[model samples]
Each structure stands twice: as structure tokens, then as C-alpha cells.
Target: MSTIDVVEVQPPALWEAKRTKQRTVVWQEFGLLGIFTDQKPKIKQDGICSQQLLSTTEKSGVMDSVGVPGPEEYEEQHVHEVYEQIASHFSSTRYKPWPIVESFLQSLVPGAIGLDVGCGNGKYLTVNREVFIVGSDRSTNLVKIASQHQPHAAIVADTLSLPHQAGRFDFAISIAVVHHLSTPERRKEAVQEILRCLNAEGKALLYVWALEQKTSRRGWDEGHEQDVMVPWVMKTGKKNPNEDGSMEKTFQRYYHLYRSGELEADIAAVGGKLIDSGYEKDNWWAIFQR
Candidate 1:
């Protein structure tokens, strides 16, 4: 069995590694289609956000097949990572405020156990007292900052390689971090892992840079520094110092420039059903149902 296997097996590839009698095994493979970003609390009825929300019940972003990371590329990934390490916990992002996070959480309805899946700086998780929340991220340094900031609600883990129980959550929120994944495989793995942790009816919310938005604002466009944005495997998993006086081992992740269709396909392939999705100005946000 693959070390990564956690679900029942019927392996057609990875997750479908078991055999069973078949009869033209069919699936609703309608070409997947599908992110959005906006912080308007108490939105106007039947407005743009409302329209996008309505469309999601039928069709969402974009959907398309994606390639896996090469096996050779896996072992080759090893390097030190320097992550941002200021204790920026409490309600707002480095760019905005706590109420924005609260307002977003409020839209999801009350009492849904939620997660800040790349909950950097522990900002929202720290001060937003109403939601049943848990915090997770790939960076140990950032996790430390989170623990120091909101010790009650944090866990250190990678979305690519999660360390959580299956169906353990009701909802997950990722903000301004999905694009950093760098590759399609990592992207799928991240989504798959997150879904694995959700209850069947659970939700996964993401705040991502909008593909339709002008590329000038994103760091991955041309003239972007490869060494800075795309991480390099330094010494093959060896511990090393980074920019912020912390230590990390670089894992293989490739940043992707998403189109709507590709995002939708990803959610469906992993047994997910998209609920609501849209893009607003600079970022894209979507919520998927497991």
C-alpha cells in the first residue's frame, strides 16, 4: 500500500486501488468548470456576489485534468525555508482587519466547525471568538507564531501531507495561500488532503488570487524572482536556516496559474462537489462541498 493511502482501496490509480466487478463503470464526467475574493459583509440582495452564489448551485469556476509531479522531482525536493515570522495574530490579515475575517466566517452560518488551513500569523483564529475553529499551516515557524499568538487553536502541517483524522472537520478556510502551491499535483494533493479531513457534508473555503485579475499584482508573473517565489530543494530534506531565523525543509510544490475550468475539475475528481465560487477584482474565493 502507498504510504499516502488512507481511504478504502479500489486502485485505478492511487485512491482507486481495489478490484471489483465492472459494467462500463460510469461517472458524471461532464467537463469540470469553475475562485473569488471580496470582503463585503451584509451584501446587497441579488447583487453580483449573490448572482455568483446562485450560479454555483449549477456550474462553478473551471474544471480540467492536471498532471502529477514526477517521481524524480519528489526526492529532489529538499531545502531550507524562511517564512514570515512576526506575531501578527488577531482578527485581520497583514493587509486588512479582524472584522473582515469575522464577516467571512459569519457568511458560512453559525456553529460550523471551521479551519483556517494556512492560518498564518494566527490573525483571525486568535480573536474571532464565535466560530469553532482550528488552525493549520506548513511552516513550523509560523505554527510557533500561531501557538504563541493563539495557543488554543493551531496545528503545524502541510496540506500536501496532512496529519489529521479523516472527516475531522466541518469547514476549512485558506486565505491568500493556495497559489503558492506552485504545481498542479501539489494543488490536487492539497485539495484531496483537505477533503479527506472533512465530514461528508463539510465545506472548504478558499481565498485565492483571481486568475482574471491583472497579473501585475501577483508575485508569479514575468520578471518574478524564481528563487523567491518558487522554492528550491536545498540539501534534500536537511534542516537549514531561512530568512526569519527559523529552520525548515522545503517540500516539492509548484505554483500554478489557474483557469476556472481546472479548479472545478480538481474538486470533482476528488469526490467533492462545488457549492459556491466566483472571482472579485484581485482574488478568487470558492467553497466546495465534500
Candidate 2:
């Protein structure tokens, strides 16, 4: 009774208010007992406390720590956006068709129905008029450009999910396109989609950037990531248009570089019979029969 005075300590107003609000939400959502029963908060590598509201595995499928988009999302956004932004520049540089591609088109039977998946600028579509070719691409801008260049029809459609009927096309070609699929699953899906659109005896051709190209005289480097965004520098002119001397703008395009046998293996995985496969001129080409 003689003389001790009791004192109470309180957290700072702002911090205490935030804590109160959090507690209120927790209680409202899970009830008061849940505050104790829930798992302890986890400190992330970045030194922030995670709510521990959902299991790590539950959220891991959609996003990583710090909320970065997963591979599929990143690939879709990057590939489509970059292609749209640089469609004109890209089309201007893609006027020539590869000789091998031309040969494959020439081999197709006359009046045979064909599909061109990811037919940028429709370079290959212009070849082999005897074969009625329909082109599809993911980029609308590229599709428009393709429509202007080729008399064949062009549609903005994804290779993984073509708008065509199954077993409709006698032949299909996906040149330098499957490599844009940033994951093995996606690459396989695209090949399978192509196969699905083909008749039982239908054949398809695929081209992918070769990993061996790094050793070629062209000096193409296989970057550290198998799936990477390669930059395309568009130079305004040799002379600097700006006083500051910046005449080039770099844009990123997605690519999945393939090793010697990777393209063959991917096609085979989808029950496609490989007719022939080889590495040529910084690319891996394969002919497959459905």
C-alpha cells in the first residue's frame, strides 16, 4: 500500500493503428480463435513478414515471392507485346523466305490445304500458290502485314490453340515459331496442336533457333537462359537524328534456343513421326508426319 505506482507502455499510434486494423480483419474473416490457431508469420528473404494466410505451395503455382509473374505469363506478355511494337520493323527485315522452307512448300501436293502457324509477314505463304495456304499468327499487327503481302487468308490465332478444325489441313509449317514458345510444355503443345490440325498422313515442318549457332561464324551467342528475350536494335539511320547521339531503339523478342536433338525429341513426344531432322544455318529443322 505504501507506494509503488503502476505504469503502462503503448506502441506508437500509427503502428498500433495498423496492428489493430489487421487484427480486426483477421477476426472478421477467421474469428478470434483463428488469430492463435493460424501458423506463425514468416519472414521472407526480402525481410518482410508474410501473413501465412495461405500455404506457400498454394501461392507458388501462380507467383513467386515478391509477386513476380510466372514463366507462362511473362512469355505471353513479352512475346505478344514486343511483336506488336516492332511488327513493321520486323516485317521489313523478313522479306526473304528460307530455301529449305521453299523446298518444303514446293514438295506439297497441288491444291492441298495447308496451315502456316505463326506466319509473320507471310513470307512462306507467298510460295507454292498451288497449295492453298491459310496463315495464323498471335500478333494482329503481324497478321495484317501478312494479309497485305499474301493472297492467302491470315488469322490472328495462337499456335497452341488454332481456330481450325482437327484433321483439316493436309500440311502445316511452323518456321522459326516454336522457339518463341518459352517452355517445353508450351512447345510440345504447339507441336501437338499442329499435329491435331493435320490429316493422318499429313506432314509438318518446324524450325527452331539452334544452340550450336553460338559457335557459328555469325557470332550468335546462346545466352545463359535457354528461354531468353533477345534484343533487336532498330537504327534510325547512320547519322544521329537526335543531338544527343541516340539513333537506335532496342526491342526484346522471346526465343527458346534448341540443342541438336531437342526439336526432334519435342515432336516425337507428341506422337509425331520424325521424317527428317538436321541443323542448318543457325537453326534446327525437322519434318514430321502425323
Candidate 3:
């Protein structure tokens, strides 16, 4: 991605429902730190940008707070930066929501209000006008992009501490954002925030990146090292091992990969139920009824 993409992000301009002094900042990484790639994620190769957008890099100095930025802020900032970087690799105009999100929306109650948390550019808004949908993302530029794409859709704020009232949306869907969270503690909070926003009996749909059960754990970017408890290697690289292990690994962090059974336990801890869960397109999509 071009450095110009950074120039496009305005930290002060990021979306905020109401600016408050000493606002309680929720620092959930949302899995941004998990991009443990030996290779730098480039826009061109990732197919996130076209040649024209890559020519320039925008510089927006980081100006959130005085002390070291917290993990959530760090991850959030990283995502915005990556978002800009990837923009150079692909046309931001083109979009198509994944089948799971689309299919879930199809079952919505008439006049049901839906929240697309991390709604990237509001492509779903254009497709599902039948339901009242509001798309929101922490990235100010992306929100603006979404506004341009889906003018009718409401785009605003971060999910960590949402501005909306409890039970605001009939259902809330967070796709591909959970994996950005580096730690499970942060992810659970995100889940709570989402659950808090849903009405009783409301559904919260989430998609988490997971490795298949049958796949060998060795191929992961974060290799597995041997476990003292388990016979085989739990981790391979230097420090962090077992991060690349089995489904149990992801739950309690037995593996870097995520498995349905592991996630279900995590979901249960937060008083959320995984009504339906499955693997599709390398993502474990869970439909949770609160």
C-alpha cells in the first residue's frame, strides 16, 4: 500500500458520536495484531487497490493521546492504516457482502432494524434496502466512503463503547473484525458490547477466522511448538507456541486456529448462545441469539 493512504486518515476526524473529556476508551485489538506474516501485506498483491491509488501516501500524524496507545487504539489505528494501504490495491467502489451476511439479512423481520458493525463501505446497504440498515465503522474515511456508497445508511462510531441505547438494533452483525483482536479478553468485551446492543431475543452474527480441523497445524504462519501436556509439538517458532495448535488452542488458545467447539465455549462465557455455527470460506460464521 502507498504511504499516501496514511495521509488519507485523519485521527482527529475519526467518527465519534460525542466527544467527552476522559472518555472511557475501549482498547480491543479486534485481531489486527494477528497478521503475523513474514511478508509485509502489500496492497498490489492482496488485490486491495488499483495502480492509480498507490502513487501517493497520505500522512496523518497519530494524535490520540499522550501515553502509549492502548492495544485497542493501536489495533484500531493499524486497521485504518491497513484500510488505506489496501485501498491502493483495489477499487473501493466495488463491494459484495459475503453470502452468510446476505442470507442472514434475508430472514430479517419486516421493518427490522439491523446494525452492520464494521460495515465496510455499506455495500450491503445498497443490496438490502428492504430492511432498515445502519452501517458503521471506526475508520472515518471508510465511513465517508460508505456514506458515498450508501447515502441512505447511517454510519457512525466504534462498537467497543457504542453511542446507541441498549437493544438499539434487532440484530447486529460483525464480520471479519473479531480476528483483528489479538487477545481473547478484548474479543469477549467486543462480544459483550454487541450483545448489550441487541434486544432480548435479538441475534448477533459474528464471523471469526479459523483453521480447519483436518488441516495440519504446521502450515500456519505462526508455527506450532511442542506441548508439554500434549505429545506432539504445540508450537514451532521461538516464543509463542500452541498458538498454532488444535481447536482447544483457540478457545483457551490451544491453537492459533479457531474451531466451532472452542468458540462456543467462549460465547457461552458471555451469556451468548451460538444458535448455528459452521465453516464457510475459511471463516467460522456463528449466529448468536442473545
Name the runs in model 1 displaced over 4 angstroms.
Answer: 1-80, 84-102, 108-111, 148-152, 215-254
Error of model 1, residue 154, in angstroms: 1.2
lDDT: the better of candidates 1 and 3? 3
Local accuracy of candidate 1 as per-residue lDDT tens digits, 1-290: 11111111111111111312211111110110111212222222222111111222222211112332232232123111434322222222353433434566666655667777887767666555556777877666676666665334778766666667888787777776666664456667778888888988788876665444333322233332221222222322235465544343232232334555566777777778888776655556677878
User: How badly does each model clash, as a count of residue pairs?
Assistant: 37, 0, 35
Cα lDDT listed for each candidate: 0.49, 0.69, 0.54
TM-scores of the models, in the order given: 0.55, 0.73, 0.60
TM-score, cand. 1 vs. native: 0.55
lDDT by residue (tens digit), candidate 2, 206-257: 9889866645432334442344345555766767553556565555566777
Model 3, residue 16: distance off in Å is 28
Worst 10 residues of 1 by lDDT: 25-34
| Higher-scoring candidate on TM-score, 1 or 3 | 3
Q: For candidate 3, what is the lDDT? A: 0.54
Q: Which candidate number maximizes lDDT?
A: 2
